[model samples]
Target: MMKRKILVLKYSFLAILLILLNTFNVNGQDEFVKKSFTTADPLYTNLLKATEGNFKNYPHSFLENGNIKYYQIDEWTGGFWPGSLWYMYEYTKEEKWKKAATAWTNSLESNQYNTKHHDIGFMMYCSYGNALKFDDNPKYKEILIQSAKSLTQRYSPVVGSIQSWNTRKSKGDINLWEYAVIMDNMMNLELLFYASKVTNDPVYKNIAINHAAKTMQNHLRADYSSYHVVNYDPKSGKVLHKQTLQGFSDESTWARGQAWGIYGFTTVYRETKDKRFLKTAVKMANFFLDHPNLPKDKIPYWDFNVGQPGFKPDWDFDPKRFKETPRDASAAAITSSALLELSTYVKGKQKQKFYNAALAMLKSLSSDTYLNTNNANPYYLLKHSTGNLPSNREIDVPLIYADYYFLEALTRYEKSK
Candidate 1:
């Protein structure tokens, strides 16, 4: 009789423990969602107030000297503002956010035909892509198809890659590059893949596959760390240069560029179901996550090797001026969103690792250290993003794209739960 009583007590205790754990988990997610909105609602509300319905002047970044910088509709980051608005509409189902997102998304219609740059995907997909998720407008699909067509105009049959930047002299007369492809260009291929799916044409998908294959071969190192720019001979498809235009040196890894690789390749794997792309994405993700220089908070410095021995760049900045290197919240945000999607593709411990890492990054980003609670930068969301640090531009400021990805990560986190 005493043994039976003991077993009953043990089982009761186990049941209570499980209940408590489940309740705590649910409450934790609720708290995160509550906090996210509490911070974002005011900042985005202020953004709309400041703009006063001006769709042409997209919010880009908050400058160091206390000014809200705006980018034209044609800029690389033009879509992020609208993308964030779309996320807001998705979360709240509020008409104001939807109306604002529609107007801002409509402002960038001209970018569908922009063939001069390789960032049309970033400028179009991020906005219209998210818009279509809520409303399946045929116009949105047609616009995206046209954007993909324009992007294909920059592809080289010989190089098997999309040209990132046109031939131009550097600071000096450095025209050694006939064709340049940056790691960031991996992101633009999604538009082409989407176009192929909608149009039932393999031409766009074939171009994207060729570009991904060539990039996998030439742009990534043995450790999967990527070069910022890989220059190719236009006529022969020969890799002319594998160097850095935005990192600490020719050899150092740029944090945002690495984040772009993780996000881009994961996206490719999603669209293609190619195991090679999945393997590459996993390797690149591990490289970023396992790097010793990655801070405890998961937000990384502008360059992974910054201030370390033998990693100096020939830029004009004074290293001594900054007591600690600047962190790129944008990198963390982008990686967090990518990891959430990647977690769905894997199972067991790998899935848990990615999911937990993404949560940690989101936690750090939502904290007071990174979240813009005081409206110091009224036009932007998160702070301490490094954009083009070597060129002395947009350092340690609030960037629009950082906010877009942060909101996106939060949305993905909620859905995964």
Candidate 2:
């Protein structure tokens, strides 16, 4: 009887040990996340500390004059601040972030009905879409559906794509881009895809699919590098011209535009699980990763093909302009998130390459050069992001979307482990 009792106890001990081992094995991401939080926690705390009294205003981008520039509710980037708050809320599970997210997100309620252009995805999906993802509030869902409706108002069946921008207001805008369908616009389809799933309506999904298919066919160049904008004749749905408004030239690859393509197609794959989208995403990623001009740190210059041999901008556009070009941390953050997601869907060396590239980018962004925890800016993180460098606007400033995607990448990394 004594021997039997001892044997039972030994078996129980072994079972407990095995259970604990399984728990650790399943939570490798959590372990890395805990280590990361050691660095991230203070940055967020300092951010809240810096923005203590400034949360009322919606910060869009920073100015070189050392001031936080505010934007109206209708501004394309207005939702990113609130989206960042939601990500922080998700990471920390803190009440303050939740409260802040609610306040900022509610401020954009009127945007649900605004039909000026096709950025409701950036304006609503980044804000409310994340709100629903973390909290699953029905009100957020309704607002997203309404925003999707507003976005569809900009889609033209003739063009088979959503219109990106209206007529350019100034010389700073892209030349020959009147009725444009930009690569950046592909990022907006996430909102429509989500709306379709929630409402059980195929129209929204179909619109997103059509737009993506059209953009995939037209926007990408022969080498898989993307054009910034494709001007289409609104009347006949004909391609009028292709121009690179924000890139070095019409022929060069804008780093952020490439990042947008990777992110958008990866997202499309996520929503639809279509192998074609995944393949397209891989093609874009390969172009970006294997490009000769890509910085060794995995951060890319504002444009990759700026000064390659035989590369000349339109009309003596200064081929030497690539000297000391600025890095777009925003692109790095966006690409990191996309590659992390792509890693899960792929296997073998492709998966390893994608995961390693994302990890390297994340590490680079977390450094002091890019991660701004200093008191100079309290409401934002990550600096040196270039926005419209051609116009000399928001150069080397902290963009709100940069912070939004950085937090998202971190969240994805944590959950993946």
Candidate 3:
């Protein structure tokens, strides 16, 4: 009888231990969610307020020529202002941000028909896309569809790509763009894809697919780095020349161009669920991540191959004289957001690696080294972004899009966790 009683006490102790472990697991999970999701970054609000104040004066792109300024509706960066406001609203659920976003977005209504360049996506979708994502407003849908249609006017069936620019002759007596397609054009494809979804039309989707496929075939090097522009014969679709308009050289990888490629392809994969795009994105990301020139913080120089030996590229000024070349925070912000999205679609070590790299970039960008906390420049969030280094324009300055993508990365991080 005594032995039986001892056995019952042993089973009771085991049951109690199991209950305690289950409780501990639940509490651990709750702690993780509370720490990651519920905690908001105070910087977001501070930067947004700063931007609001600056917008009251400038009402457009961030600082230019050491002064606050605005841009035309067709400017490549015009949509970023509204897009950033949308992101602010997305993060905070604040109505003031939404009102500002709507006002800025409406200011771009004329841009729906502007076909002067391939940046209509950046102008329209970045602003309206987020609005539609949350509000499902029919007006945003109509504007985006019209913008996509306008973009389709630039596609060339013969070249299987979208034309980026018209012909131009440089002082060196070199003529460009009988048919020019740029790496930056890849970013515009998203608007077309989204239009296809909303309109139930395959034409827009097909154009984007053909352009992507052709670009994959002709623009990328074996190492997965991309050319900034590829020119072709308009009539016969014959390849004419591959060149770098913004990069250090025809052989170099422009950091922002590379970032655009990764983000573009990752987005394509998300829209289509095509494994080929995912594979391509992975390859391109590997090239960027593994390159020796990549900084320890993961923010890259303006052009990856610029400072290397044996290459001389034309720039408006000499890059070699600078003690250290400027880093592109815009590229880092775009890449970090793309990497966070890419991590969700991948598995195993690759997934963890992408996530960790994105987290590191966020940490670096959030630091005083990059983050613009000083009220000195309330119009911008992060500083030291490079734009058109070859042309001696906006180098090491804060760009509107940089702030947009930084907020975007933060929002994505909150959701991803």
Q: Tell me each candidate's TM-score.
A: 0.96, 0.87, 0.86
Compare the candidates by TM-score and give the number of the best one: 1
Model 2 error, position 395 (Å) = 1.2
Tens digits of lDDT, candidate 2, 130-173: 88876778888999999999999999999999988886642344
The TM-score, computed over Cα atoms with residue i paired to residue i, of candidate 2 is: 0.87
- After superposition, which runs of candidate 2 have C-alpha atoms over 4 Å from their true positions? 1-56, 169-176, 315-323, 373-376
Off by over 4 Å in 1: 1-10, 171-175
Native-to-model Cα distance after best TM-score fit, residue 212 in candidate 3, in Å: 0.6
lDDT of 3 by residue, 285-391 (tens): 88888899999999899988886886677545575667798889999999999999999999999999899888888877876688765544645677889888777
Could you arrange the candidates by lDDT from highest to lowest?
Answer: 1, 2, 3
State, as a TM-score between 0 and 1, how close model 1 is to the true structure.
0.96
Candidate 1 minimal-lDDT segment of 10 residues? 168-177
If the candidates were sorted by their TM-score against the true structure, best first, what order would they fall in? Answer: 1, 2, 3
> Poorest 10 consecutive residues of model 2 by lDDT?
169-178
Q: What lDDT is obtained when candidate 1 is compared to the true structure? A: 0.90
lDDT of 1 by residue, 1-55 (tens): 9999999999999999999999998898668766876778778888888887687
Mind sharing the TM-score for model 3?
Answer: 0.86
Query: Which candidate leads the pack in lDDT?
Result: 1
